[model samples]
Target: MSRLELSPNFSDPDAFYAALTEAHRERSEADSERINARLILLLANHIGEQQVLEEALSIAAADSEQPR
Candidate 1:
């Protein structure tokens, strides 16, 4: 079974966030969407596990559909 690592895994989360924001800076809405798509695909590819990826998709979808 795939373990959903619900923990702080990044050594420099702040720096990673800064870089992510920087990547979106000066980009149009469509451009930002494209970047996000590419990032997701790359990360999913890195994971390379259908079960884990499917679990992630389900969790994300469920969470997003919930009332905040």
Candidate 2:
């Protein structure tokens, strides 16, 4: 089984967030969503593990219902 790494693994999380926000800045909602969808697909392809990706999808869906 693939190990799920639940950690702050980014070397520069703030920079990544800033870049992501900048990509969405001044964009229409639909365009922002397209960017998100494409990004997820690209990253999922990079991961290339169906089981791990499914686990991630489940975790994300569950987390979406929780209060931040």
For residues 16-68, write the lDDT of model 1, one tens digit per residue: 99999999999999999999999999999998889889888999999999987
Q: Tell me the whole-model lDDT of each prediction, alpha carbons only.
A: 0.93, 0.93
Number of backbone clashes in candidate 1: 0
lDDT of candidate 2 over 1-68, digit per residue (tens): 78556887999999999999999999999999999999999999988888989989999999999998
Worst 10 residues of 1 by lDDT: 1-10
* TM-score to native of every candidate shown: 0.92, 0.90
- Clash number for candidate 2: 0
Candidate 2 wrong stretches, greater than 4 Å: none
For candidate 2, list the clashing residue pairs, or say none: none
